[model samples]
Target: MESAELRELLTPEGVALLDSLPPYTSSTDVLKIVAGLRKDGYSASLVATVLTQAKLRGKAVAKFGDFAQRMLFTEAGLEQATRLPVAALHAGRYVRAGLTSVADLGCGIGADALAFAGAGLQVHAVDADEVTAAITTYNLSPFPEARVSHGKAEDTDLSDVKSVYLDPARRTSGHTNTNRLANAEDYSPSLDFAFGLAEKLPTGIKLGPGFDRDLIPDTCEAQWISVNGDVVEVGLWFGPLKRDGITRAALVMNAEGLHELTAATDSTDAEVGELGLFLYEPDGAVIRARLIGDLARSIGAHMLDEHIAYMSSDVAVSTPFASTFEVVHEFALDVKVLAKELKSRGIGTLEIKKRGVDIDPAEFRKRLSLSGKNSATLFLTRLGERRVAILAQRL
Candidate 1:
């Protein structure tokens, strides 16, 4: 059914009717429902409609809170669905820089639209899917002035857009085919196409955290955004209005968490590698910012390799900017011997990390007979000219 029809069916009475059906007790139940829906040719809109209706019928709200949370928001958009702090931050930055209007292409569910409107800027919210347009319209109900339209990203006119905001459809509707945008060329509304639109105005593109850095435009500024410690999204900024280079932003959001960041460019000094007593892995946001070298310098730590993301130092840094761990043991070589030694040490629990190593961590852990009492991290990597296993503990 169309979103309008779905909305009509969402009336309290209609919702109650659907809710009267059997409730899913667990993730398995939800999965089974999804599978059955898929088999029955149910669309994403239909699935969400069913789920929402189920929730409205009081589908064990307290007991299945996690499942409901994931189903309702995380799988939908969660905070991203609302696009509060991120959009607010972006809008505030641009507003400070004298930007006034935005063309939010692919404005799914109006998260950024509402943010832009709330920021007191005129916005043109566009989405290709009618259902998404409806969702955006509903989400932006409070912001009636934000113009929501349905059209392909390329078809949307950019005449009044001072800063074009693009959030490409990174995945298909079913949440399958995660690599949908693996190639800029593969994007239905391709990145190259978005870049073309961006070249005409100051542009911001909200991207997946796992996006390939090599493909991003050289002139654009890349930002990795993390909320409380989890990296959420990566945004690329373009035009003369933006600060040049990569910026890592650590945002603590609760409608009130203080935000701090480090914005560094490719021109910054190259970082050197040194093995210290402790090692650190920068948060996903920091890594996405392409400011690993800058962060290493700030922490007075060194990199494991110029290209690698790990940082090391003997000095303990209490900052939450990166995940810190202490190196408990190091081996020059020997997967088999190392495994045997760990097994003998009553180390049955293993968490393996690798950089430039092709071995599967799970398979390697399985090769060793590990027990639950001893949990250790095995870093398979190259330091200088040797393959080594460095055991580490969270610090």
Candidate 2:
């Protein structure tokens, strides 16, 4: 957001108006609210700012929960901010490690910094953007131990800090149209500088979940985290923050709670075996962390194909790391024949899953001519060189 818009939003009148506004429902609702405010003699700029904030708060619920209502956000800041539950986990690491003070470099809107302060740690939150820093200061106003600075992350003094948390800016400049920077060197503080800080002190560096595996340092612990089936971020822990003998880990969090799988070394791929009674699909975090073999061993399963992540087991087993499905039928992957078979079996609603193959599920679904009362999940994949289809029921 621009400075003038931010200044207006921070005014007492603006705060009162925003609080009085109802929760945003849709674009039409926003227009109606804006028009009503304008008709009530509120300035156009004030109405627009309040509407934007109302919209942002609605979107922020998934990340910050109820706390989002009191917080302000930029489009890009909210988009890249860490979820509150996940941020608590990050704070727990420092607390468990006996660190009391943290320097949160590149702290966007102070989301992670808020978590740190909430965990009772002193936080020095820094952001290069002026508007972002202002928002960060506002968001962190409740925590006296947390301070926001508008400056480059690399320029921040960390000599007195117990540890550091670096979340480099991974996108090019734009409020709502930001584009991701694919190269590590393109990050605001640069990966080299971030890694250097890690080498100097106990540090946690957050990067994209799909960060290059080869670029990871051998001395640090790399943990990939997923929330509600979506792989979110990979955190690299160095120095005192690194867990002993655990170089890689996968942490999955859902409504049930958080579960973690770790390995001291890279896990060897599970051996390929014939299709068994049940098929399993490992969580995305497991695949990203290369811990599929460990998960497979825990459930007495084998890989369905050497090159594929799908696993097969003779017995049905419940595991948090993977979703289990019972195999109902196996057939050669012929679209016309498969469509005929599905129709004959009275299968109508279908969920198509594919791996190690080239097929557009949506386009292919149109050709199936689906019509029935039954629902089934179909897996289109390769068994060695042969293309195959496995119809399964979710367990």
Candidate 3:
């Protein structure tokens, strides 16, 4: 956001106008709103700013929930900010570790800072963008002890800080619609500088789930966190923040509850065996953390292929770490044969899953000529040396 726009947004008139707006939706008559606001003598810039904020708030519900209504956001900031629930989890770690004074370097829109303050910890939220820092200041206004500063994450003074949390920027610098940066070294604060601080103070670094595990420091705990089945981030914790004997972990959160699988070191992949009565698909975070062996052991499952992440077992095990399906029948990879079988079974609604295969599910679905009232999951994968499709039902 520009300084002029920030000035207007921080004003009482802007605040009241934004608060008065009805909840925004895709169906909202944006043109009507603009005409009405302009007819009321509001400046074009103010109208645009408030409307953008209203729209962003509508989209931010998935991350901030109700708190989004009272917050400000930049396109990039909202997109990059940590989800509120996940930020709370990060704050809980600090509180549990007795690190009450932590610096949040590269704090985007102050999501973590908000959680830190809400958890009753002193927060020092720093960002490279001056406007973002100003907006963060407004967002953290309720907490007198929470400080917001405009500065480089690597250069920020941390003499008084107890612990540190860094979420390096992974996109080109901008307040809106910025392009993503792929190289780890290109991230703001740079991986080198961010990882160097971990050697000194207790620290937690938030990274993309697909970040190179080989690049991870040897001493820190590597934890991949998934929320509602989506692996959101992989956090590396060092020093006092690292859990004892838990260098590798997968934290899965869903309707059932939060489930964690941790190991002191990488787990050996489960031994391969013949496909069994049930197939287990480990959560993405589990696979990312390289803890599939632990999950397999927990559920009495064995790998279906030595190289594949899929596992199976004769016993139907109930666990949140993996989704289980009961096998019905296996068919040769011939599409006509499978289509005939599915049609005969009256299978209409199909949930297609595949691994170790090359086929588009959507295109393949069309070829199935599906027309029925029943639903079933079809797993198209290879077993040993044969390509087969297994019909299964959720257990």
Candidate 4:
């Protein structure tokens, strides 16, 4: 069929087909009709445009469509949601701390709100988009005392809220739309403004994971969260959740089922020395919180250098802050010498890790004639202004 016909078919019949089909993952799948028409030799763009309009209309009426797109078209929605840890890694902490109610401002598709409600907290979820608001209502239907409303966060009365969750819009456009009303600053919504609005109540604001440490305010506690070793989001905590320190790094993992790897300024600070034989790199969350010194002390390790994130140790033990690796072999520098050393050891494959070296890993491997059978981690670094490489394995 032609594109126009295909677009028209999606109005009711197409939606039924979609509902009947197995659940689609990406929101962009809602536009698959254009692709289907194109495969049948129809005008793709024309059909896509019509279908797009119809899809928006359907979303506005029924409150369901591309959630990320709806939020992105308005402002920075995509950037915020993807950057924040939406999987609710810290929900258990929130619940155990006695935070019984949450007002999820700009609750997008109600991902975090649903997590909170499922954790047995009453949720007052709000979104500016009418479609998103309606979707939140439907998405949150199973939760007890979960209420969804349509309005801008600034306009919503929050007197009943004891814990506030903010995931501000951060992307300027959809993949197609380019108009933007605000920049990163606008997406931030001002720490002062957040404190004033949340005032005395616990508040959590989700921010870009890569945001600079300087941007975090002194009054709030900053936490960098990592899930399964990926640095997912940075959370700013206010009121009772705030820690009395510079930053707190939390490595929350599902390993051993579900367990949190928490280390902060209070627990990590120690009188450790310089990097030793065994090198440890703490999780991204711990690094973000600047708890390297504390982590070193906790694990009885020391910093290799002032600039490097690696913590050195002569002994190895399983620790939450860092991954422990064993050093089984050593190689002296001079690319030619290193090549000869590896050859004598019958070593070939290499995993190169760097800290202060300017050497490209590929080039280093090529220079060392690295290619054969054994796999080893090559650490490139500077010890008292001298270039060196350490060969190590998991301890």
Q: Give me the candidate number with maximum TM-score.
A: 2
Give the Å error, residue 297, model 2.
Answer: 1.1
Using lDDT as the measure, which candidate wins? 3
Per-residue lDDT tens digits of candidate 3, residues 1-395? 78899899899999999999999988999999999999999999999999999999999999999999999999999999999999999999999999889999999899999999999999999999999999899889989899999999878999999999999999999998799898999999899998899988999999999998899988999999999989999999998889999999999999877899999999998889988999999999999999998889878899988777899999999999888999999899889999999999999999999989898989999999999999999999999888889899988
| Model 1 accuracy (lDDT, Cα) | 0.68
Candidates arranged by TM-score, highest first: 2, 3, 1, 4
Q: Candidate 2: where is the Cα deviation over 4 Å?
A: none
Candidate 4 ranges beyond 4 A from true positions:
1-16, 22-90, 128-138, 175-184, 243-247, 257-275, 329-348, 359-369
| Tens-digit per-residue lDDT, 211-267, candidate 4 | 766767666767777767777778887777665544455654535433333443435
Looking at candidate 2, the ten consecutive residues that score lowest on lDDT are: 23-32
- Residue lDDT tens for model 2, 267-318: 9988889999999999999999999998998899999888899999899999
What's the lDDT for all of these models? 0.68, 0.92, 0.93, 0.63
Writing each residue's lDDT as its tens digit, candidate 1 over 1-395 gives 35565575556754454544476444436766767766866565667567654643243243233333222222333323424556677777677768888888888766677778889988899988776676567557677778889998898878877788888876655311233445556655788887886778888888877888787777776766776666777777788546755434444343245545656554253466667899998776766666677777888988887767788998989665687899898886576788778877788777788886678888777777676467778888888777888889987
- Lowest lDDT 10-residue stretch of candidate 1: 66-75
